[model samples]
Every structure is written in structure tokens, then in C-alpha cells.
Target: MQFGPFLKKSLPKYLFIIPAFLFVVIFMLYPIFYNIFISFQDVTIMNLKGDKSFIGVENYRQIFQDERFLLSLKNTVIYTVSCIVFQLSIGFLLALFFNQQFPMRNFFRSILLLAWMTPLVITGTLFKWLYDVDYGVLNYLLIQIGLISEPINWLGQQSTALMAIIVTNIWIGIPFNMILLLSALQALPSDVYEAAKIDGASRIQSFFKITLPLMKPATLVVLVLGIIYTFKVFDIILIMTGGGPVNATQVLPFFGYELAFVNFKFSLSGAVATIILVILTVISLIYLYLIRKEESM
Candidate 1:
């Protein structure tokens, strides 16, 4: 390979990447670095444009001590875990169902995508009405089915608020998980399953031994993506609960929003945002490692 010819030929391709590179730097990398820098400083509304003094880890320390921050962290964990578990499991089941030749399978799968395709704001608002304590469809259905004597305050109480949000997130996330898992299922080699069948493996046994193992990469991708998306969920919560019923549905993203915009604690919010970034980065790294290991296998 002649270096000069190779460089000339690749120059336009490299040029094409420059715009994308600059966009990432301007939009993503710069914001992240700036947030990290601000997290170490006292960047309140008072000192935002004035003099910002270095506070080191004091913001982080204070946030950890704050009861609301702790609650938000706990809620975030619950929300993320619940969404992932239910989304992945339900999506996998849906994928399995849709993978088999069935009447109206394609139509049903497309219908599921409507939930995923709708904007979060719209979905949140719709669910807000659905979960209304009085005159809500959910309550009416439950009452008709004799599940409860009265309409439950789904987003009103501390006990049920997080779960309500979790359920919404799960509903929004299932289609994405299903589509990805379905694609993986479709791509799997049929020979393996056929061999397993010849060896006297039942459907359940084949799924556990062959399908599950083959689906690991896709499953890992879905899980990591789901965790990242669920952990940073802000809009739905904002629309449905506003992190409320006394901070019941507060997650880290919403908590950070409250700190920055509501309470004007910029540094504290930055700290919270940085914490979220750190968590997502760690999850992404683990996912990469798992993917590489699976690829090697």
C-alpha cells in the first residue's frame, strides 16, 4: 500500500467524519466536561456569572447527606430495575410469541410499536389521565373487575407513585426490547435448534439451552440500554408527577432538575448529573466487556 495514494483516497471519508466529530464535541463532550467542572464549583444563581469559588466535593457530600437526594436515588434504582426487569421479560415473551407463525402476528407487533413510537410527553400525559384517582379509565376498569373498592391514587401517594411511574416506563420500553430481541431471534441459526430437537430436547429445554445462550449478546444490549434510558427518565415523571406527592416519584434526573431550576442549586444539580453520567459510563463499559467476550466465544 502506497501511503500517499491511500491518504488521498481516504481524505474525503475522513473529511466526512469531521462534522460528526465536531457535533459530538460541541454537543456531548463539551457539555459533559463543563458539567464536571461546574460540579466542583459553587455555581449558584448568585455566583453563576459572578465569582464561582471552588467547593471540591462539598456539593457531592451535601447531596449524599440530603434526605431528598437519598430518596431520589432509591426511587431511581427502583424505577430503573423495575423497568428493566418487566420490559426485558415481557419483551422477550412478546418476541417469542411474535417469532412463531401466528395469525395477525405482524399486526400485533406493529401495534406494540405504537406505544414505543409515541413521544414521551404524550405518553406521560395520557397515563396521567389514566391513573387519575377519580373518573379515570384504569380505576373504572378495576372497579368493574372488582379489583378494588375505590380508585387508588396511583401517583398521589408515596407508596404507589414510583411504581406508577415504573409501570409507565415499562410500557414505553417494552416495544423497543421486543423489536431488538425479535431481530436477534430471527437471526439465530436454525440448525442448532433442529439438532437440539433431534436430541430429544423439548421446546422449553431448547429455549433454555440454545435460545437463551444464543441471545445473550442481544439481551445484554437491551438491558444496558434499558438501564441507561430508565435511569435518566425525566420527562414522563415531570409530566405525570412532577417528582411529587411529596417528592415520592423523584429520581436523580428530576431531582437534579429541581435543584438547578426549582431551588437554583446549580452545583448540587451538576453533582447529581455527574453521578448519573458516572453510573451510565460504568454500565456501558460493562456492556462492552460482555459484548467482546461473547464475540470472542
Candidate 2:
């Protein structure tokens, strides 16, 4: 335990972690700080590789004043909230169902996970076809069921475009929620439920009184992670709508991409990214707090 021997023994362990730590510093931390730095600067495609001129909070002010940014923020909030609600609800139900004894339960659960396992871009493209006004399965099925008189432009019309994306997102998100919640469900002590039953508690009452309270940590984790992931959704919306139908489905990340690449407003793009970074940081802090709380409990 002397200093020299301790240093010799610990050197290898410390060296093992150095590479990954350096990678994070070089790739993740550096880029994040650099982005924050440029967000306040008047950077552009023309001046990007040249010199960046700091302009204080001008970029922030400009983006705040931009109607499209406001609209994108609104869309992002709506999309995140809707996806969370449906995904958590449906996923929780699926978790509960699969947790019960049933034939082919594991098989069906694995099959359902195909949607989550599929690439988001691919899922978006597939749904684009499914949402087609004509020659689409959705409309065909609806017509077969006599729900509508004719095919409706699900992704073409502004009124329905956001809803279409939300539906696809929920489909892709459900499996993740289900898998996590199911694990939490399986981890619950059977003795608790047995005791509740002995006390004459109904299934519904037991679930509300015992299952829910125990699952709070998992639920919070799912919610926080869901919000962060859904907020940063870009490829799916980009491939499906390109933030189109008059920008009805434009979210903050896509809007930032537009500002940086499509519009070549690097400063504005950085500002939007900084905002997203702030939001994500807050969420991460909440996640860390929950983890600590759970551990303490």
C-alpha cells in the first residue's frame, strides 16, 4: 500500500480508462464547448473556416424573434409530450400484458420490438409510404373498414402531418418503454403482491397501491430519456416530411439543421443547438437526481 507500489499497480487501471476519457474529451466535450462558443458569434459558411466574430447575444435575440424558431419550439414540445404520453401508456400496458403468463409471450414481445429495432430513418420512410394518400395500406384498410369515404392525405396536409409523425414516433418508442417497464415489473418481489392478495386487495388496487410506487424510479427514467430522445428527433421527420407541409412538423433540431445547412446561418444554428443543449442538460440533471434518490432509498 506504499505510494510507489500503489502507483505501479494502479497505473494499468488508470491507463485503461485514459483512452476512453480522451476520446470523450476530444470528440464530445470539445465540440460541445466549441458549439457554445460559436453560438454567440456571427459565424457563417463564408466565415466559418475564417474568423468567428463574437456578437454577444445577437444570435439568441434574432432566433427568439424568428417566428419559425418559435413555431419549431412549439412543434418540439407538442411532439415530445404526445410521444411520451402514448408511448408510456401503450408500453406500460404491453409490459403488464407480457409480464402475465401467456403462450408465445416472449415471441410476440420480440416481434413487437422489431419496430424499435428498425432504424428510425427506415421506419420514417416505411411510414411515409403507409401514410400515402393513394395506394397506401392505411387508407386501404380504413376504406375496407368504411371509416372514411376516400383516401386522405395523411402527411400532405398540415392538419394531419404532425399527427402522422407522432403516430410513427409512438410506434417506434413503444418497444423501448415496454422493455424497460417489463424489466421493472419482473424485478418486483412476488411476496408483496401475495401479501396484498392476502389482505383482500384486488389486482387493480394492488397495482395502484404497490406496483406504481415501486416503479417510480423506472418511470422517471423512461420519461426523462424519452423527452431527451424525442426532442432531438431529426432524421425521421427529415426523411418523412423535411419539416414540410408548410413547416408544420418542424422541430428545433430540424430547424437548427435548416439554419446551419439549408440557410447557411451558422450563428443562428449554433444558437438553436445551444438551446437544445441547455434543455438536455436540465433533463440529464433530473435523471442523475432520480438515480441518486433511488440509490439512497
Score every model by TM-score.
Answer: 0.95, 0.96
Task: Kindly report which residue stretches of model 2 are placed more than 4 angstroms away from their true locations once superposed.
Answer: 1-3, 290-297
Error of 2 at 216 (Å): 0.7
Q: What CA RMSD would you report for each candidate?
A: 1.7, 1.5
lDDT of 2: 0.94
Best by lDDT: 2
lDDT of 2 by residue, 1-297 (tens): 599999999999999999999999999999989888999899988997898887999999999999999999999999999999999999999999999998999999999999999988789989999999979999999999999989999999999999999999999999999999999999999999999999999999999999999998889989998898899999998899999899999999999999999899988999999999998998899789878988898
Model 2 scores a TM of 0.96
Which pairs clash in the backbone of model 2? none
lDDT of each: 0.93, 0.94
Whole-model lDDT, model 1: 0.93
Model 1, C-alpha of 68: deviation from truth (Å): 1.0
1-297: candidate 1 lDDT, tens digit per residue? 999999999999999999999999999999999999999999988877898999899999999999999999998998898889999999999999899998998998999999999999899999999999987799999999999999999989988988888888889999999999999999999999899899999999999999999899889988998898889999998899999999988889999999999899999999999999999999999999989988887
Looking at model 2, report the run of 10 residues with the lowest lDDT sum. 45-54
Error of 1 at 71 (Å): 0.5
